[model samples]
Target: MPVSPLLVVTRLLRCLSIGLLLPCVPTGALAQQLASPRDTSFTVHSAYVKAKKQHPDISIARPPVPRGVRAQTKLTYCTPGSRALQLDVFYPKAKRRQQFPAVLLIHGGGWRSGDRSQHVPLAQQLAGRGFVAVTAEYRLSTEAPYPAAVQDLKAAIRWMRANARTYAIDTTRVAVWGFSAGGQLAALIGSTNGNSLFEAGSCHRPHSSAVQAIVDVDGILAFLHPESGEGNDSKSTSAATYWFGSNKLTRPDLWQQASALSYVGAGTPPMLFINSGVDRMHAGRDDMMRQLTALGIYTEVHSFPEAPHPFPLFNPWFQPTLEYTVNFLNKVFPRR
Candidate 1:
């Protein structure tokens, strides 16, 4: 073998050349990376930009905002003893207008990890359509506990109101919006509607977190902690247990009580819920919507026939969502 060193080196060089000529990554693995959040956003942004270029009405060059529009990242509220509270605010450009209506967006991550920044594209999309969109971050269960997130939401609402003039927002017309876990909280805010008991026991000053309307996209409505019931979903996690430490099966009374459906009485806000018509996600959207409807509340339901769970903010119907949201604002916002 020592006598064939030159031949062995020649063979190794040939193998190295062949390897370099092959693709850097396997085909499937590279595709998954492209679909990841980072790549997906870049792709979607390019698409949005190209589409806007083709149709300029959808976008306008407004300074004071980012390259596309006016956005400010600031701490809206923070945990009592921790430096945790923050929010991203997106609004129209200077030449646009003053005191526009706002949408407060909360993200979903099983109440353990999602942040408002993930929804920046949606915020920008909303801002592009003349709405002041805010994506807020609240304490998660690991960092805090139940009502901590709710309290943060309430604080955000109050902050929006108290600093309305400064932020150029019209507090009279605010909407709470969320996807999945966030959707549940949005429903809770809509259902509870200024309840004093829910607002108590938080370091945050007691303030109303209620909204004129609520849009919950695939959110669980009940807190069925220790979740049980012959019909309860076994394949998925329940909002009651994840956010509150129990499920409906073990806490039947509490489940029925905390379920957003239970609180839909007279004077509840108009609500829009979009979900697939099954357990793919949003386990009991139908039941919640039905219960709310029975209470004489204005409810609109749109189920994507075959869409998968948690449709990204880049789906085709994204524009339709925008249209419907704007319509809701037109009917609810206050006059100058």
Candidate 2:
């Protein structure tokens, strides 16, 4: 039987589609060959300064209290532009300067948009339960790309530590939590041990930007990936290029360097990844759990039957998701 060339081309396209869809952060240190200087060049404040011109009302919308949650907000960081860069801390108030476990939460906005206010309710709810909650804004790709977002985050970690006393923060037990694009950024901060994505910094900080635990919701596991049947549309792969200064096709190895899973190790923190239904875009959710479990790292993954992306934050406004997140927090920080 002669095989048609047409069939071969069609099959190739299908495989490419699958490749885009199933982007499991390459579970190996394939890009560690270049001993890039331990740096934080990727962190910058100019973009946020430019973005401040278009700021949206500077107010956070909070969810109504269910039972045992208290909320307060305070400015935590500022960019040179004082616009796109800022952070908000939410938590239960202490008598004076008492410390509590903290969760650094990042908001999702395709890497080029979004702000701390978008995540206010989540921050407040977490803080209400005796956990210090932080929502931070970072420079995005339109003005700064790749390491800029991650660098700002690493700076936030450092800032959190430096001011832990004033904020009543438990610097030793902090974790990072994020959704969608923010999730990828959070994981990137966790991975590479705070390696700068670009050559912008020469003098480095002595302390680390590592989080003790991670919670990523519907994040991109790989950079070149665009999900099955999805084009390099603005909603998906374009964000990769905008942030990293290149696309997956042009910079495959760079993509690997940007993923959290590739940096997993014995010292890497435990994880909790949540996925809504098995959309082709998020198939790697299982692969991540599988890899982390194989490494003896404590992990938990959940699938909300029939749910779609963003339910954990914006749906019916989180009934069980709230319970599930708080329960997970309790399990992780029972003493705090």
Candidate 3:
């Protein structure tokens, strides 16, 4: 039986979505594509359009940056060789000499797409509320795999501390907030604080990447947990497969190592899990929270009953999400 050309193109498109452009891809086109960075197809506007289909009235417009807050965009945080990772800082206009607690925001796009701007609204809101909020860009899986994104984020934290005085950031009260894939990174960052394995090649070694708290917005704790939908590569390559550069079966070690549940301990920082209605997205959350609770560490969970996975970027849910985050941060890092 002869396969249709349309079927072949459709198959190739699926692979490209996850950064796998090979096998059926043309030799010349493959070489050209590999020479450049993969496309970041995810964006706040695109997400809003998709979410609006289900909830038509939801507004994507974030409240304007308040008068008390200011923004500094495109500031370089890390320069690994020629590649420069940039971050945007949104902070309260300091009236006195006082420093404010900081939060580093990481955006999510299944590890391959999306950029820092997706979370700018949240960062701005946090800044208006007396926190120095930063939205950071990391090397996506399309550009660099697994540890690269983690390394970029840890570097961003180090950047926060390195420039604490300039930004009026209280380094001692730093926290990380990430959505979806970024959420996974945030949890892993908190869980693996001071772990030497992920510290290689990271700059600002003098400034620690340890975060006092973590806010995971619908991120999975374990990639191989029973509730996880990751690592399934039966048809095209899955996001986990692309990020890890291998399937769960072939790279179980990476899967386990990357799981936040694998590193929970006495020193683990306080964590807040904000989840949507997706059960698979909450994989290992209960077990991880249980472990944290057993160790006497602070852990909390909040769910939006039937909200979308990207609810934090939409209306009705977005306001509540901001409130939950502000409340959590206020509780953990209260003013002196």
Q: Which has the greatest lDDT?
A: 3
Question: lDDT by residue for model 3 over 34-85, one digit each (tens)?
Answer: 4436656778888888888888888885888777788889999888766798
lDDT of 2 by residue, 1-336 (tens): 444557645654564455442231111232132222322322213323332344422222246743544553555454534333567776666776577888888877667765666667777777777788888877766555566777777777776777677668877778888877787776666655545552233212555566777777767665544453212654555656546655566556767777776676776677777766646535355566677788897788766755545555544425555566677766776663
TM-score of each: 0.70, 0.72, 0.89
Steric collisions counted per model: 14, 6, 0
- In candidate 2, position 314 carries an lDDT of 43
Candidate 3 residue pairs in clash (backbone atoms < 3 Å):
none
Off by over 4 Å in 1: 1-68, 94-97, 200-207, 223-240, 287-296, 334-336
Task: Find the candidate with the highest TM-score and give its number.
Answer: 3
lDDT scores for all predictions?
0.63, 0.62, 0.86
